[model samples]
Target chain A: MKTIESRSNPLYKQLFKWQSSAGRRDEPILLEGVHLCEAFLALGRQPQYALFDQTRITEPHLAGLIENLSEEVCCLLPAGLLANLSNVDTGQGVLFVVRPAVATLPTHLNANMLWLDRVQDPGNVGTLLRTAAAAGITRVLASTGTASLWSPKVLRSGQGVHFGMHLHEHIDLLAVARTLVVPLIVTTLSEANDLFEVELPVQAAWVFGHEGQGVSQSLIDLAALRIRIDHAQAVDSLNVTAAAAICLFEQRRQHR
Target chain B: MKTIESRSNPLYKQLFKWQSSAGRRDEPILLEGVHLCEAFLALGRQPQYALFDQTRITEPHLAGLIENLSEEVCCLLPAGLLANLSNVDTGQGVLFVVRPAVATLPTHLNANMLWLDRVQDPGNVGTLLRTAAAAGITRVLASTGTASLWSPKVLRSGQGVHFGMHLHEHIDLLAVARTLVVPLIVTTLSEANDLFEVELPVQAAWVFGHEGQGVSQSLIDLAALRIRIDHAQAVDSLNVTAAAAICLFEQRRQHR
Candidate 1:
């Protein structure tokens, strides 16, 4: 395998771009650690290229992974250089340059879908995606202000669910709301139906809003159902991800 | 108000110590940002001391908080000095040194409680605490290997729910399980009843395990109920916090 020792190497500079949020767009993003790499490979897709830290090549898991990849698409880098591109504290000693499958918004948003209205935190966004996928929902849309779905932090928090999901970002949610045929369920803080007591539609578009602010007024005006998860008054509200899990799973529990 | 201009100031050093996980034990931990400070004050608790960045002290929220505090216990510091002790990216120009209420284990572990088994990530542990509190489960126990409950990261992610929870850390689970009067609900991967189909107990101790490992074999053996959340199977499992929310809220729904 070829070794890249210098920081100034062209390939190293190209890989470095994949580490930033801006770099994540359009370009193939870097997938770190064994879990994500394994997830990507499990989807019957191949990485454009793979990099392994020379120091960890002998490790059993890393070695087994390397043995599977063709020699041309694999390379070795010194530990320091590899660590520089790693977003996590402990570098996993491996990264795959792979392009995520581009997804298109469906004409009818009728499935049990999730619409994120500017969910800001990367972890929250990622966790919502994972929760949605686990609930067997295949489609998700995010407004412009939401965290980028493919950012490294979101990817790590997502824990490999991104592969199985069909995600659309920078969405015009208002426009979509106008034409939507399914029940539009928006979570509100007050004066709404209780999530548990409400008659949930079999398939609907669920909207979760910004962390600090609840769903925007325009969306609330358009909501076919405005529901709230009733909790003790001691705490103001549940975390967005936690709320999503409860709401989605409750819907699942009812239909099951 | 007193002004602290030097990094060599003893008070600054003491505040700096509270920034680390090791410093959180048996000491007044620092509470950052307006939300957390407001949450603490809402509990009708006074800060041992409060610090504000000199540059942003005139801002309305900071000024308002300062107005309510006794001048003797509040101090002003340069923005740089204040930022040094901050754990979050954007410093809110304020910090409160408050003592968390000490909690003792009650003889009866009979409440609808959550037992965290070696949950490692501070974010996960904090989210779990926040979720548990929102679900109206006031008591939570964390095993020894779990993240430090009072660490700065956990406290930040917890979003002031720490003030409402009766948390006991460094717990011996097996011993607690033996004497536990209520049903012990443990989540497992296989050969268990489905969470949705199972008849959940009205009052039980819910056990959520480490991120990678399910509940320990010993604990699983002792479980009164072994349950697993049925998902699409495209992903491995629900996040620990997500699972806790679903289980706790489901119990709430059953009895509601």
Candidate 2:
């Protein structure tokens, strides 16, 4: 029956710290809204701490969630408190602080994966995670220049499916490149085969680069194949998110 | 040699009107930033009116563009004025009011097309247009509930490629469904075949739906085929933009 009323409370201050991208730790990140809570529960993981909106207790779905948590791990708070913690206007009414299980990338890359280099937009980064997971990508590596992988915006955009992913951020693309054994594909505008005409490897990595620049030269040098989406000659290029989805699913299409 | 400092100046007011979606006409929409200006010039289209940032005059690229404009069609404005006209923080220091050629969607719906039924996110709508144009889809028809095709946000996300596509907004889905001459594909979560397993038509229309709901029931009833991307069974769905890209490119892959 403990309740948190003041923003200055020790627990509130700590949760606030975790909410920021810079304050995040390597093990766990803040999980916002009901969808993420469900994702954690579906995966048999418990939130270290849970906050509930007094007003939403009547919601059967949320109510069922509250019933399952131990008394020591959950608390009821003002709806306004929970609402302010989120970036979106209508924040989903629950919040959880959960530690994710550790994921280790193979020393040598072999499976279908996505290597994101300096893909800074949070929405694009999040959508890429969702799409990569949907395309059954085995892993996703975000170089140091990429958006903060565990930031709230990235989590919200991911719609709570990060649990199923072997997502590693702040890694070095050059280090990964040295160990990659499969066909390494990087998209470029020149000396490229039309994406449709090129048969994709059954298990290979698709590296998508920054919004302004194509793949970094260091990684581009490692690419066994450089392909381009055959677009209208008048248009410059596709959005990074669109390009990633088309590339990943094309590979998935070939294998399936 | 005249400058407009007053917001009430007739031309300034008119340009402001075009900045909004509701005030849009059947004529050309405004293109903001340097990238869009380059796109228009690259296509060899003359701007009806152009505005330059006084601060950016020394930039070599802008100087080249200004040199190309006819004296009657272009003017220089304070950097502040040009920057305020855009939604992005760095407004790229150039703007154009170019009249694009008119395009029509056939009543018969024979060609490859994208029928968007209430796909409301502006970014999603803009990305869809970019993808459809890249896939070489002939026309895009947006339902009445869809995002305003000419809104400032859409225009910015669209990156001026809107100029190359036949984009129509606030259209009826039923009328379009009735006129179908090819397989009308709708994406849904249930009783749908795996997207990859099904061979997509070389030339056919794909109808994408809203963010929350799938395609309208009325339109879904008219669909000759319902296809879904095969993903991990636990996750809810892929973002609508990702779904559209995967489906369109799969068809593109088959034909190529």
Candidate 3:
């Protein structure tokens, strides 16, 4: 295994750039910490590189896991360099770089697709992906304004669930909505029809709008049905990610 | 307004410590950026102190908002000092400190309540608060292992929903569960009954467990009903926050 010590090292610089700009630029993501690395390995995805700090590699599980990886997969960095290379508070002495899996939209349309419009938070994007996957919605079309589906934060938030879905990014949601064969279900606070009261089509596209502004008027007009989660009078609405989960789960329930 | 120019300034140092350690320690919390400041003001919550970078106060809305605040509400700081004070990138040139709100649980229990167990992420905890408010669940109880509901991260993530609900933290969940006059509904992937299949009680306590772990075994054993959201075979389960939203919405549907 090769040792990289300098903060000025080209590889270290590349890792930092990748970490900060993974969303804006279409580059391979850097996954930090032991838990994510273990999950990656468990899924049989070979990492391009695995960097570990020598000082913290005392635990048997950590040591054995590093030892078991192919010799070419390992690289040891000085503690300072490893710290500089990771984003999290506790680096867990390990990090890896893997090519982000290309996310594609499913060729065939399903009624249970999720259309994300300008949902910017990476954690929310990731949670929505996990929710969509759980609701058995295989396809997610992320409008250009939405966070990158493959960004490290989203990936970590998704907790490896991205591997199970068809996630398309930088999509024009209006265009997709126009082409869909199924009814478009858009969630809005202003809508009077409670999601439960409305007979959701077994096949429908669930569209979630921006966090603050919500779904655009154009998208709302495009939607065949505008549904709202019934709530008490005190609060306005659920978070977009949470709203997506509720809507998708309810849709799944109807199909079931 | 007074000017705080040095990192060594006692108040500045105290603010920095509060920003970084507020979550871990039960002390003052740091609130940064214009949005949260606006939220705090809208909620009629006063800040202990606010620090502003004159250079970054370019937006009229921000300036106008600040002008409307009491004369003692803020102090201007050198750009470098303000930069040093923030933890996030693009600090937008302002930060402040506030005492954590003492949110109370309702004295009379409602049919619907939100019970959170061992939820560690501050953002998730905040989102749950927002979701609880949106779902119209007036009462929320966070278990001992849950993140601090009043921490800056949770407050920011909650997007002002904390001001809307009866929120409690560090409560004994089992004792609360045992005392609920309404049915205690626990969400778990391992549960035999799908959420939709069960005739969800109109009035019930909804329990969401930790991020990775579902409801605890003891809580599940004590729950009046255990329910699972039926998902497609391809996905495991929804993110805990998302799951909470779904369950709460389902319960809201029953009453409607």
What C-alpha RMSD separates each model from the true structure? 1.9, 2.5, 4.4
Quote each prediction's TM-score.
0.95, 0.92, 0.81
Candidate 2 residue pairs that clash: none
Per-residue lDDT value at A36 in model 3: 69
lDDT of 2 by residue, B15-130 (tens): 77666533155755677777778867876678888877777877998888887777788867777766656667877777887765556666676788898999988988888887
Full-model lDDT for every candidate = 0.88, 0.79, 0.78
Model 3: lDDT of residue B73: 67
Per-candidate DockQ values are 0.83, 0.64, 0.63
Better of 2 and 3 by DockQ: 2
Candidate 3 CA-lDDT value: 0.78
Residue A15: error of model 3 in Å?
A: 8.3
Which numbered prediction scores highest in TM-score against the true structure? 1
Better of 1 and 2 by TM-score: 1
> Candidate 3, after superposition: displacement of residue A18 in Å?
7.0
Please give the distance, in angstroms, between residue A170's alpha carbon in candidate 2 and its true position after superposition. Answer: 1.5
Question: What TM-score does candidate 1 get on C-alpha atoms?
Answer: 0.95
lDDT digits (tens) for residues B54-128 of candidate 3: 765667856866775776868888888777767677787777677766766555566578888898899888888
**Candidate 1 residues B120-199, lDDT tens each?**
99989988998888888888888889998988778878899898789888899989999999999999987889988987
